[model samples]
Target: MADVRKHMIFHGRVQGVGFRYTAKYLARSMNLTGWVKNEYDGTVVMEVQGREAMIFELMKGLNRNQFIQIDWIDTEEKETETESSFEVKY
Candidate 1:
């Protein structure tokens, strides 16, 4: 499938854990591009763009981490980006 972008808000136990790092790793390894950051509300926000399957795999990878307990994820599709890297934004 073609590339797609998703803006996501991950809730519950996202901060104080290695959520950002894990997301960056997973995204990059899968050749996905975008950024992840911690929000002031103790939630994690991310925008990732890549193949649909890879995006799904990225979600599965995040959920597999023992420390990152994602109570829920709010996701929305967006216009794709040109960047070719995944990052953990500060």
Candidate 2:
């Protein structure tokens, strides 16, 4: 399958709630490569690159978090990058 990249911006109570850490962990477990960072506008932005199924699974994993309330997600399909690992960007 051709790898895909998704650029997502998650809104709601995402920051200061371990969202980035959880995303990083889930991405590593699923062997997805990308980076996640907290936006200045109280949102979280992430770019996940992997198979379609794995990327969806990562989203599901993120939604399962109790403290992180994802009110909305703005997603865009982008050209894939040669990222080797997922990281929590500061």
Candidate 3:
């Protein structure tokens, strides 16, 4: 499958709940490359590049976190970027 990139912003009780860390870990485990960070508007933003299935799995993992409540996610498909590994960005 062709690699895909997604620019996503997750809303609702995402900050201060280890969302970024969980995403980073899940991405690494799935061999996806990208970065995740907290936004000033109480949302979490991530740019992930990998197989479409892996990306979906990453989102599923994030959604399953007990402490994280994801009301919705805004996703946009974008051009892929070169990245070596997943990262939690400030």
As for candidate 3, its clashing pairs are none
Clash totals, every prediction: 0, 0, 0
What are the Cα lDDT values of the candidates?
0.93, 0.94, 0.94
- My TM-score estimates for the predictions, one after another, are 0.97, 0.97, 0.97
Single out the weakest 10-residue window by summed lDDT for candidate 3.
81-90
lDDT of 2 by residue, 8-45 (tens): 99999999999999999999999999999998999999
Candidate 3: segments with Cα more than 4 A from true spot: none
Give the Å shift of residue 73 in candidate 3: 0.7
lDDT of 3 by residue, 29-86 (tens): 9999999999899999999999999998998998899999999999999999887999
Error of 2 at 56 (Å): 0.7
Q: Pairing residues by index, what is the TM-score of model 1?
A: 0.97
Runs off by more than 4 Å, candidate 2: none
Please report, as a residue range, the 10-residue window in candidate 1 with the lowest summed lDDT: 81-90
lDDT of 1 by residue, 2-58 (tens): 999999999999998899999999899999999999999899999999999999999
